[model samples]
Structures are given as C-alpha cells and as structure tokens.
Target: MKIVTIFVMMMHITGSLCAQVLQDIKLNAPDMERGLTIMKAFGKRASATSFSSKDLSLQDLSDLLWASAGVNRPENGKRTAPTAVNAQDIDVYVLMKSGAYLYDAKTHSLKGVIAGDNRKMVSERQTNFANAPVMLVMVSDISRFRGDDTEQKLIWAAMDAGIVSQNIGIFCAGTGMVTRPRASMDTEGLKKLLVLSGTQYPLLNNLVGYPNE
Candidate 1:
C-alpha cells in the first residue's frame, strides 16, 4: 500500500512538470507602426558582438517572429520571406530559457516543441552566445520542395534560409534589438533534440537580444 501511494505521488509530480514545460504560446499581432524606416534600418544593420541576458517582452517577441517569416498576406497566405518555388521550406525554431517552440506562421503563434532550455545546442562551441535571451534556429525541410534533384533542392534551401535570416537581421536593426546570424551550432544534437526528420536540416541560427550596454 505504501509503495503504491509513493508511485502515485511521483506520477503526479511528473505530470505537473510536463505541464509547465510544454505550454504553447499564442503570439500577439505585429505592431505595424513600430521600428525605424527601411533606409535607417539598413544603415544601422550590423552584427552584434554581445547580447543582454534579459528576456524579451511578449510584444517584441511577437513582432520579431512575424517579421521573420510570418504570413504577410492573409488573403493568399503568403509570407514575408520568399522561398524558391514558394516551397516555404524554412522553419524557425525559437529557443529560450523556458523551452523550444516552432513558429506557426499560419496562426501567428508558437507551437511548443519541447520543454527545458535547449539554447546550449544552438550556441554549441560559442558558449558566450548562450547568454542571449532568444535564439532562432532555421531548419529547412528539403522534402517540401517538389524536385527530383536533391542537390538543387539543397541549394534552394540555403537561399531560402538566408532570406529568412536576413529578415530577422533587418527587424532587429530597426527595432533597437541586437542579433547575429551564424552557421555554428550542434546540427546533429539539434536534430535529435528537436526530433527533426531526415529531410529537415538545420542550416543557420541567430542569437537575438538587447545590446549588453
């Protein structure tokens, strides 16, 4: 009877922990009026050398993801960043201290992927970058592209990923935030952590935060 009681309590504790870790985040609408002008953002755009550890506000995070690759044209379901053949191959995974989430462009929200801090996998050898409050890891699912040539599909994936990363850079530059696009990360570890399929490849990542001033 005592053993049975202890097992039940342990199961209850595990269930509570799972609930805390896998909570989905419904993002807010993007603030259309915010940020600097296109020219100003272009001028200010530069790679950040350091980042603050402070977490971003819900609004800022919402805007950031929307700008990254959210659906800009609601009428046709088009996105801010264009992909080759409109494949929409790139997927942005948001890694924070709390958990990892996949940005659902159609719904403009974050779908919880896994629980616990996985930023270390994105930071990899650049341990310093782990301090950034948020990390956006870009993964491309080549299977989305309708092509027989695997090599050409991979090329398109790279280009599409770069476009999304650039959007992230410009948004940060204009919005008084800091970010740096990088190719360094534990790809194999991320694949296992995120449970990525064989067709999905993590190509790039961006460390995002306020300047450590």
Candidate 2:
C-alpha cells in the first residue's frame, strides 16, 4: 500500500512539472569556515555591495545555504535560529534558478520543494535572480506556537524568525555577499509559485547575491 501510494504521488508530480527542474544536489560543504567568516564580515550591516554577476559553484551554494539556516552541531535539534519556546515556527524556503528547496539544517543541505525557476514569483527584483545567487523566504507556521492569544503567538514567531533572518545578513556580509530582507513581496504570486498549503504563508523575503560594484 505504501509503495503504491508513493508511486501515485510521483506520477502526480511528474504530470504537472515545470521547466528548469531542480536536480537532486549532493550535500558536500566541508564546514563553516566561509560561513563563519560571512557571519563576521556582514555582522550588523558593515557595508553593502551590488552583486550583479558573481557566480557560485555547487560547493559555494551548498556552503551558503548551510550557513544561512543549517544546523551546525548535532546532538540537539537546535538550529542557527532561536525559536520562541523552541517552537521553530519558521521555515526557510530557498528560491533559485534551478528551483526551490526547503533548507534541511540537520543534514546541512537542500530538499526539493518544486521544479522550475520560481524566484521571479517570490520577488520582483531583477533578471534571473541576478546579482543575488540566493533568495530566502521566511515563512511562519502558526501551529508551531502554543498560546490562546492569537496575536501574541504570531508576534513571537515573527520576531524569532527575524533573528534568524539577521543571521543570514551577517553571513552574507562575512562572505562578501549582498542581501536585503523585505516583507514587501508579492504574497499572492508567491503562494501560487510555492504551492502553499492551508497552513503555510510567506512572511519575509531576503535577496542574497554577489555584489557587482
């Protein structure tokens, strides 16, 4: 029954696939050396550069994604972000030319979300996610928090996710990369592109890329 169910799901995915499908990339970033450097270099907005044409190799992409929100140490499920009550309510969805992926911190890699260059839908920035090699969308899941007061719980999740988002900024600065986090995204457009479900919603978007200047 399980195998049959899986087969049916696969068929469904293959039927409605888009272009520029994502390849199952190999997870092979050695460690956080560059990541750590990025953390320091861009710590608290030291400077900002225009990243227009810098290209990132597979390994570089792997490393950046890991540092953005990937888990550094094992033993505990704790990630680079601080969660309110450890709710971990936020999900970081990475949009790129290849496709979109959900960052798997524990494994320090990406898991495919969908096939195609859905970056444009996530943001109205530029050509082919130009200058910015990586674009991170921070999403909050209300179910992750526990509180009778609706507003308070959501506020907590948003604040917590902000902390994680800033860490990405620092990482970018450390790596000579440029990034801008904005909530001014095309929400409706992103929902369609990401294939969001009943409980998911796009909260914030960050543009990360090599500076052109």
Candidate 3:
C-alpha cells in the first residue's frame, strides 16, 4: 500500500512537470472570414509601414512564426510554403529582442540558435530593427542538394526560400502588421553573427513588426 501511494505521487509529479514544459500551442484568430479575407487582401504587396518596439505575446509570435513556415497539412510533412524537391534545405533563423532561435518544424517550437538579441547584426541600419520585433534569417545548406550543377542548385534553393518568405509577408498582412523580405543585408556578417561556420549561408531576411500608426 505504501509503495503504491509513492508510485502514484511520482506519476502525478511527472505529469505535472511534463505539462509545464511541453506547452500545447495552436493558432487562434477572429474567425476565417475576418482573418483570411484580410490576409488574402494584401496578396503580394509588401508592408509599407514599420512596427513599433513592443513585446509580442508567445501566442502572437508562435502563430506568426508558424504561418511563416510551420507545417499546416499533416500527411506528407508539407508546410505553408513549398520546398524544392522537398529537400527542406532552407532553415529559418529567428532573431528577436531576446535571442536567436531556429524553427523546429516537427516539434513546432523555437530552439535556441544563439544566446543574444543580435537584431542589429541582421541589418547595418539600426532603423531597420528599431521598430522591428522579429527578423527571420532564411538560410540554406547548399550541400544538401546532390545536383550535378552547383550554381543552379543554389538558385533553386534561393527560389524555395523566397516562397516561404512570401508566406510570412502575407501572414503579416493578415495580422495587420508590417513585413519586408530584405535582400539588402550583409550575408557574411549575418552568417558570422549567427555563428554559421561552414556551408550554412544566410540567404535572405524578412523584417516583421506591428505597424507604428
């Protein structure tokens, strides 16, 4: 009887700890008509405004990041965006006011990439990050492609990264925020900043923020 009681207590503690650590998160919004229509309204138009430096909630950030590249459909492990040959070579590095993190598609969580708020490293101009809340650095491990032509492979990978980037832009539009897929970045600087030693190249960056109105 004493052994049974102790085992039950241990099980309860374990369950509570698991619940605390593994949070269940999902996207919530103001219904489809209101949300989807607005999101679709912007289509391909990049945001014209900039976001103010305000702390966004975990829900907001999670949904935004999920919309960027999270897996939507279940069957084949496909995501909101398409990848060339489904190689999924593109990796998204999220630089926020706190630190840098990588998107774990399978776990639907942000894993630490680097331990610092190095948003300025993403852009030379401080203004670029001044009103920004989150900046996603799209990287590609070019070696993943076993194509005969290396340059063409790089081009195709870049194309895939662009697809995912556009999704983020559209998602921002839906949420009444601002976003811009910026190619005007110091790639080498970013690679070093994010501590990308070899082959992991920062291809593009997308800046997101709540519009300063």
lDDT of each: 0.94, 0.71, 0.73
Tens digit of per-residue lDDT, candidate 2, span 90-203: 788888777788877766677787876666665575444444667789887777777677788778867976887787777666666677777767778877777777556677
Candidate 3 local lDDT, 1-213, one digit each (tens): 999999999999998765434223333431323345753747736755566787667766777777777777778788877787787778888887667788877677877655556787776564645558788888987777776787877897889789888878787777777787877676777877667857677878888877777
Q: Cα miss at 76, model 3 (Å)?
A: 1.8
lDDT of 1 by residue, 1-213 (tens): 999999999999999877667788999999999999999999999999999999999999999999999999999899999999999999999999989999999999999988889899998888877899999999999999985899999999999999999999999999999999999999999999889999999999999999999
lDDT of 2 at 96: 76
Candidate ranking under lDDT, highest first, comes to 1, 3, 2
What does the lDDT read for residue 167 in candidate 3?
Answer: 77
- Using TM-score as the measure, which candidate wins? 1
**Candidate 3 backbone overlaps, count:** 1
lDDT of 1: 0.94
